[model samples]
Structures are given as structure tokens and as C-alpha cells.
Target: MQRYELAAVTGLDSLTRVERDVPRPGPGQVLIRTTAWSLNYRDLLVAGGRYGPPRAGCVPLSDGVGVIEEVGAGVTRVAVGDRVAGIFMQGWIAGDIPGDAGNTALGGAIDGMLSEYVVLSAEGVVKVPAHLTDAEAASLPCAAVTAWNALVRESGIRAGDTVVLLGTGGVSLIALQFAKLHGATTIVTSSSDAKLDIARRLGADHTVNYRAQPDWDRAVLDITNGRGADIVVEVGGPGTFDKSLAALRPGGHLPLIGVLTGVNGAVSTAAILRKHIRVHGIYVGSREMFDEMNRAIAASGLRPPVDRNFGFDDARAAYEHLERAAHAGKVTLTR
Candidate 1:
């Protein structure tokens, strides 16, 4: 087998390909032949050591679409030739997140999907939506599932809700899709008017050019006729969280999912107390959530927005493109 290895914590430069022995599935595990992998901002953080360092030479990708090449003893959920995708949080199978679950995140603490083949516990894999291809299915488990958990499971964003999403990144795009599927009105903000146009075409009810108006949250509030949005996919970190919170209606939901606007250190306790609000810190999702999300996606016939596709060998370039924020949707790499 061949795998990308982190020779050192040298930013994305550390990831390089090398030959390796084909890994055998241990008991309760299955070996997947990776066909497509997707890049996220988290992958950039992990590669640069900001998130954390992986074991040396570890394969580094969280979300993937692959075919089951073999199933080990005790595995019953999947078998050889099954089209599947790995759940990034391998151990978050059901219920609440356990202390042990955080330690098993793919592409970081453990080996990831940037390989020709990988052995993963059968419990961490889910059957891909039948309507999707390898590249499309590869985009789901991380960003799509996280967004679904935020809207459907945590935030309770439903039909007739006015929801706000920050930026045109993967999570926000997926959340936008789900929000529409649930009949919610969606708003998006983007640095580029061009990207905002694309987002509008994808069912966004309105768009704010954040570059022209740094205070995009106000636009969201104004667009909602002062009632504010029912939910905000708060991905902009500290810089935008307070404003995103302000842009929400009293008792609305705020699911903080990213740090693109930088970390928030202090906040107004009084404001939170005065206005009833619910905020959740989303970290992808569990295997069960992925399964539920797949059902919704399949039934709705929703496809993740693909910004661009990179050759599997040019994984580093994919990360670079994402870092530059040059794409309108999910960046993918195909084997």
C-alpha cells in the first residue's frame, strides 16, 4: 500500500507519500481502499501542528469514500465491496461523546484517510448514500454530518426558521442545504459577491458581502425585519460570535463551529442572561448522527457543493487552495 506520511511537523510540507505494507484488518475492523478524500480547515490546522501533532508518518485525512476491500473477524455491519465512508470521530458511535471518543479523531491522533488503504474499526464506517459517488460521498462524514447535527439534532432549526450562516465554507454550505431541505429560510455572508451569488443559487434567501460591510450581522438582523434569525451557524469564532448572537432572535440557537473570525476570550454575561439563547460547540458528529444524516441527504437528493477537485497525489495543493479560500465549496481529492 501507499500512504501520505508526516515526516515532521513542517506545516503541509511534512506530508509526503511512501510505500508501505498492506495493512490487515484486526478483529472487528475492516480494510478500506480509499477512493476519494476531502480537505477541511481542520486538516490544515492538524498538518501545521496548531491542532496537534500526529504520530510520525501517520496518514492525514478525516473524511473519505472508499470500498470495503476486506472485513475482519467479528465485523458484521460491512463486507467486501461495500461502498462506505469513515466517520471521522471513530468512537462517537452513539449517545453522548465519551472521553475516549475525542482521542480517536481521524487524521490527527490516529492514522487517517490519505492512503491507498486503511484498516478501521467497522463501527466507524457508514454506508454511503446510494445517490452519491465516491467523491460526493467522501465529502459527508465530517462537515455534512456536523452541520446536520447542529441543525437537526442540536439547534432545532426547522421549517419557517430564518437561519444565518457565516461564510461560504464547507460546514456553512452543508448547513445551508439542510436548512433548505427542512424548509428554513437561509442567509449567507461571504467576502466575495461572486461567491455569495453562488450561495444564493444554492437556496440562500439573502447574501451579505462581508467585505463591503464588515458588520454583516446587522444585515442579517435587518433582513429578518428586526426579529433576528431563528438560528445562526456561528462559524466565525469570537470576532463574529457576539454579533452572530446579536443577530439571532431571543431564544434562537447558535452553534459555534469554527474560529475563522478568531477566538473569543470574553463575552457579555448580561446579554446572554437577558436574551434566552442556546449555543452548542459542535465537533463533527457521532457514527449514529452520520447514519441519520445520510438518510436525510439521500431522501432529499442533496449533494454537497464541490468547489474543486484535486488529484489524490496533490493533497498538499488541495490544502493550499483551501488555505487561500479560493473555492466556493468543498475541496476534494480523488485517487
Candidate 2:
């Protein structure tokens, strides 16, 4: 099987095309014929040594959707030809996240799906929602699931509540849909007006062009009639961290999902004290949460926003384009 690997810690420049024999599945495992994969900043970090090195020549991508070509003994949840996505955290199958969850995430500490074939435990592979195309389903494991878990699992967001999304990235966009699906009013911020318009079309009740108004958290306050939003999916790290608190209502939940901005910034303690906000850091969620979120997405006919697709062989180009493309959604690679 042909695959792409970050051969060394030399960054994307070191991504090399190679041929290797595809392995067969042992008992309780399944073999998936990879159809499509999506790239994320985590893949980039592992390649550039920002997230540390992997176990040699690692195939670097966690978000993929594939067809189950073969299943080993004892497999029951899915059968041959079932469309599935691999779990990023192989061992942490379900339940509330344990202290050491995600210790072996695909594309990082272990081999990943940026290849023609891969094998995973039967329980580690889950059926993709019936409605999604391979490209759209490929974006779920990393970005969308994280957003879903932050809102649904951790924050306990409810109908009639107001949710604030920090940016127009993949996670934020997906979270907006889930929030609206649960009957919560959503307010989204983006540096682009054009993208904000798109977000509005996607059911966002309030759109703040962050570029036009850098202090957009204040806009969240104004939009919620000065009560502030009940929750803020704060993706921006230091730059928006303090403002995320400001955007929240008293006793609001701020699920810190990611720091797309460079890490390092200070918090205003007075504001934290005054707002009585609860700040929580969120990683991509468990397989259980993934399944629950998929049910909601499927039932509601939620369409994942996919900005573009690149052919498998042009993997390097895919990474480069994602690095530069201010996509309103995800970029996918068809393998």
C-alpha cells in the first residue's frame, strides 16, 4: 500500500511518499480501506516538532472516513463495507474522559490513517453517520467532535441558552449548528465579514466581524441584551481568553477548546472574579460522545461544511493550502 509519512521532524518538507505492505487485521480488529482524510493543525505540529516527534515515519492524520473492507472475528457493531471513522484515542473507548485520555492519538504517538489501508480494533472503528459524504465525514473526529463534546457533554448547554463561538473555524462552525439544534441561540465571531455572512446563513443568530471590531466579546454582551452568552466556545488562546470571560454571562461556562492563536497571554483576574465564569479546557471527545453527536447530526440532517478537497498524491499541497486557506470549514484529502 502507498502512504504518506512525515519521515522526520523536518516539518512538511519531510513528508515523503512511500510504499509499504498493508497489514492484515488480527482477531477483534477490522481493516479499513481509507477513502478520505482531513488535515488539522495537530498534524502540522507533530510534523514540525511543535508537538514532539512520533514513533518513526508516522502516517500523520487522525480525521478520516473509510470503508470496512474486512473484519476479524468477534466484530459485531459494523460489518464489511460499513463506512467508518477510526477513533483518535484508541484505548479510551467511552465514558467521561479519564485523566490520561488521548495518550496515543492517531497522527501523533501512533500510526494514523493517511494511507491506503489501516487496521484498528473493531470497537475503535465506528459507523459514519449515514448522510455524510466521505469528505464531510472525514472532518469529524478531531474538530467537530471536540466542539460537540464541549457544548453537549461538558458545558451542559440547554435550549433557551445563548452560546458564543469564538471564530469561524471548523469546530466553531459545527458547534454553531449543534447549539442551534438544541434550541440555543448562537453568536459567532470571525475576522471575515464574508464568512460571518455564511455563518449567519448556517443559523447563527448574531455575527460579529472580529476584524472590524477586535473587542468583539463586547458585541456578545450587547447582542445578549447585556446579560452575556451562557457559554463561550473560546478557541483563541491568550488573545481572546480574557475577552471570552467578558462575553459570558455571570456564572457562564467557557469551554476552552483550542488556542489557534500563539500560546501565552495573561488573564484579568478582576474580570474573572467579577464574572464568576467557569473555564474548562476541552480536548477532542470520547467515542461515546462521538456516537451521540453523530446521532444528532444524522437526525437533524446537519451537513458538515467542507471548504475544499485535494487528491491523495498531492498531500503536501493539501497541507500547504490548509495552512494558508482561510477556509470557513474543513479541507479534505481523498485517498
Candidate 3:
């Protein structure tokens, strides 16, 4: 079997391909023949040693879709030939996230799906929506699940509510789709007009270019006739936090999902208090959430956008492309 591993967490150059024996399933595990993989911003952080030092020589990707080749003793959740995607946190099967969930995360805490084959707990995999292609299914495990967890699960978003999205990244684009799916009025912001046009085609009701309109919060207010948005999908960190707050209605919800901007800076607690806003920090999601999300996706026949695809051998170039941050949707690799 062929696999890519990080020789060291220096950068994309650290990813090196090597030969390995195809792994067999252990008790309660399933052996998967990985077919496709997707990249997220977190992958960049992990590759650059910014998401904490990953285990030496570990495969470096959390999102992938594959077929079950075999199942271990007592395993019954899925069978051979089942197409499935591994959940981000293998330990977080249901309910709230466990304290040790971080230890079970793929790519960082464990060998991930960047290999031709992988063995994971039978309980950790979910069936892929039949309508989705391999690359689209692979894109769901992290970014799509996080978007569902934020807008659907956490915010309880409903029809007629105004939802604000930070940018046209994976999560934001997916959030735009979900918010529109639920009949919400969607507002999207980007630095690029071309991306905003894409967002509009994806059902964004209004768009803002933060570069042209530095006070985008005021733009949000103007769009909503000063009532403000009911929910803000806050992906930008400290740099946009204040604006996110300013753009929200009193008692609005903000699901803080990413730190695309710098991670730390001063924030105004007074603004939060004054607005009575609820800020929820979203990690990816539990397996149960993934299941619910898959059901919704399958029923709606919604396809996630694939910005680009690379051959398996071009994995390093894929990483570099993500680092450049020009792609509007998920970047994927196919075997």
C-alpha cells in the first residue's frame, strides 16, 4: 500500500510518500480502502506545526471517503463494500464531545486517511450519501459537518431569520447553502467580488466585500434595515469578531468556527454583553451530527463545491494550493 506521511511538521515539503503493508482490521475495527481525501485550513496548521506537533510519521488528513474492505470481530455497523467517511473525532460518537476526544482526532492525534488503506473503529465510520461523488463525500467529514453543527445544531436556524457568513471558504459556503435550505435570508462577505458573485449564485441574498467596505457591520445593518442578522457564522477570528458582533441583532447567535485571521487579540466583552449575543465555539462535530447532516444532504440532493482535484501523487501540490488560499471550496485528492 502507498501512504503519505509527515517526516516532520516543517511544511508541505515534510510530506513524503512511502510504501507500507496494507493494514488489517483489529477487533471492533474496519479496514477501509480510501478513495478520496479533502483539505481544510486545519490541515495547513497541522502541516506547518501550528496545530500542535502531530505524531511523528502520522498520515496528515482528517477528511476522506472510502469503501469498507473488511470488518473485525463483532463489527456490524457497516459491511464490506460499504462506502463511508470517517468522523473527525473517532471517540465522539454521540451527544457532547468527550474530554479525550482530541486524542482520537485523525491526522493530528492518529494516522489519518491520507493512505490507500486505513483501519478505523467500526463505530467511527458513517455511510456516505449515495448521491455524492467520492470527492464530495470526502469533503463532508470535517467542513460540512462543522457547518451543519454550527448553523443547524447549535443555532437552531429557522425560516425568515437573517444569517451572516464571514467568507466563501468551505464552511461559509456550506453554511450559505444550509441557511438557504432552511429558508433563511443569507448574507455573505468576501474580499473578492468574484467570490461574492459565486456566493450569490449559491443563494446568498446579499454580499459584502470587506476590503471595499471596511465597516461591513454597517453594511449588514443597512441590508437588514438596521434590525441586524439573527445569526453570524463567525469564521474570522479577532480581526472580524467585533464586526460580527456589530452585525448581529440583540440576542443573536454567533458560532465561532475558525481562526482564519490571527488567533488572539483584544475583544470587547461589553459589546457581547450589550447585545446579549451567544458565541459558541464549534469543533467539527460528533458522529451523530454527521449522520443527521448526511440525511439532510441526501434528501436535498445538495452537492458540495469542489474547487480543485489532484491525483494522489500530487498531494504535496494540493497542500501548497490550500496554503495559497485561492480556492473557493474544498480541495481534494483522488487515488
Candidate 4:
């Protein structure tokens, strides 16, 4: 089998493709014939040494979908020929995240799904929605699960509530879809009018081109007739954190999920206190949340946007595309 591993944590050049022997499943494990994969911003961080220093020879992706080609002794959660995706946090099946959960994370803490075949604990995988294509199913484990965790599982989003999305990236676009799935009015912000148009077509009630209107928060207020949005999917980190807060209603829900605009910056602590904002720091999610989201996806027939697809061999090009921020939704790699 062939896989791409981070030979060094310098940049995209570090993704070195190499050959390896396919391993067999041991007790309670499954050997997956991975067919497709997707890139998250976190992948770039791991590649560039921004997230943290990864171990040498670390495989570089957390999101992938495949068929169980073989199963080991006592394995019952999944079987051969089952289509499943590895959960982002391997040990976080349900409830609160464990203190050592990071140690079990794919790509960062362990070998991930960049290879043609992978061995995973049967307990850490979930069957994906059948309606989704391989690329779409592969996109779910990280970005989509985070969106689901933020909107449905935690926020209690309901009809007529307003949601503000930061950019037309994977998480934001998926959040826009899921928010609409629950009947919430969505407002999406992007620097590109073209991307905002795409968001509008995806059921966004209103779109704000942040490049044209620098104070996009005020636009959200105007759209809601002075009542701010009920939820803000805060993906911009400290760079846009204050504006995200300003865009929200009093007692609104804010899921702090991304750091696309760099990690550190000044924050307006008083506004959070004054508005009674509920800021939830969300990672990807537990496997239980992934199952619930998959059920909703299957019911609604939701199709996540795939902005681009690359051949598996062109993994470097896929990473470059995502790094350039040219794509509107998930960028995928397929066999």
C-alpha cells in the first residue's frame, strides 16, 4: 500500500509519498479499504507545524471513508463490506471529551487515513449515510461533525432563529445547510460576492460580502430588524471574534470552532459578559454525535458541497488548493 506521510513539518513539501505493507486487523479491529479522503484546515496546520509538532512519519488526514474489507476477532460494531468513516477522536464515543483524547486523534496523535488501507478500532468507526458519495462521506468526520455538534447537539437551534456563518469554508457551508435543515434563517459572510451568491443558493436567507461591507455585523442587525442573530458559527478566531460577538443577540449561542485568521489576538471580554453570550469551544465531536448527524443527513437527503476533487496521487495539489482559500467548500481526494 501507498500513503503520504509528513516527512518533515516545514510545509506542503513535507508530504512525502511512500510504500508500506498493508497490516491485518487484530482483535476488535477492522481493516478498511479507504476509497476517498478530504482535507481540513487542521491538516494544513499539522503539515506546517502550526497545530503542533507532529510525530515523524505521521499520516496526514483525519477524514476518510472506506469499506471494511476484513474484521478481526470479536468485532461486531462493523463488518466486512460495511461503508464507514473513522471518528475524529478515536476514544470519544459519547459524553464529555476525555483528558487524554488528544493522544488518540488521527493525523495529529496517530497514523491517519492517507493510506490506501488502514487498521482502526471497530469501536471508533461509524457507518456513513448511504445517499452520500465517497467524497461527501469522507468530508464528514471533522468539518461536518463540528458543524453538527455546534448547531444541533449543543445550540438547540430551532425554526425562525438566525444563524451567522463566518466564511464559505467547509464548516461554515455545512453549518449553513444544517441550520436551514432545522428551519433557522441563515446569514453567511464572505469576502467574495461570488461565494455569497453560492451561499444564497444554498438556502442562506441573506448574504453579506464582508469585503464590501466591513462592518458586516451591522448588516446582520439590519436584516433582523435590530434583533441580532441567535447563533454565530465563530470560525475566524480572534481576528473576527469581536465582530462575531457584535453580530449576535443577547443570550445567543456562539460556537468557537476555527482559527483561520491566526490563533491569538485582542478580545472584547466585556461584550460577552454584557450580552450573556454562550461561547462553546467545540472540537470535531464524539462518534455518537456523528451517528445522530448522519441520521439527520439521511432523512433530509442533504448533500454537502464539494468545491473540488483531486486524484489521490495529487494530494499535494489538494492541500495547495485549500491553502490558497480559492475553494468555497470541501476539497476532496479520491482513489
Per-candidate clash tally: 0, 0, 0, 0
Cα deviation of 153, candidate 3, in Å = 1.0
Give a tens-digit lDDT track for model 4, residues 209-235: 999999999999999999899999999
**Which 10-residue span in candidate 2 carries the lowest summed lDDT?**
47-56
Q: Put down candidate 2 lDDT per residue, 1-335, tens digits, no spaces.
A: 99888888667887899999988988999999999998776777788877744556888898888999998988888899999998878776787677765666888878889999998888887788988989999989998889888998889999999999877878888889889999999998988888898899899998988888998978888998899889999888888888888888989998987758766778887887887888877878888888988898889999888878999999998888777747887889996
Between 1 and 4, whose TM-score is larger? 4
Task: Locate the minimum summed-lDDT window of 10 residues in model 1.
Answer: 261-270
Candidate 3 collision pairs: none
Model 3, range 7-62, lDDT digits (tens) per residue? 98878878999999999999999999999999999998888788865566879899
Lowest lDDT sum, 10 consecutive residues, model 3, at: 47-56
Error of 4 at 2 (Å): 0.7
Looking at model 2, residue 40 earns an lDDT score of 77
Cα RMSD of predicted structure 1: 1.1
Candidate 1's C-alpha runs over 4 A off are: none
Q: lDDT for each of the candidates?
A: 0.87, 0.85, 0.92, 0.94
| Shift of residue 163 alpha carbon in model 1, Å | 0.6
* TM-score: model 4 vs. ground truth: 0.99
True-structure lDDT of candidate 4: 0.94
lDDT score, candidate 1, position 283:
83
Best of the candidates, lDDT: 4
lDDT of 2 at 70: 93
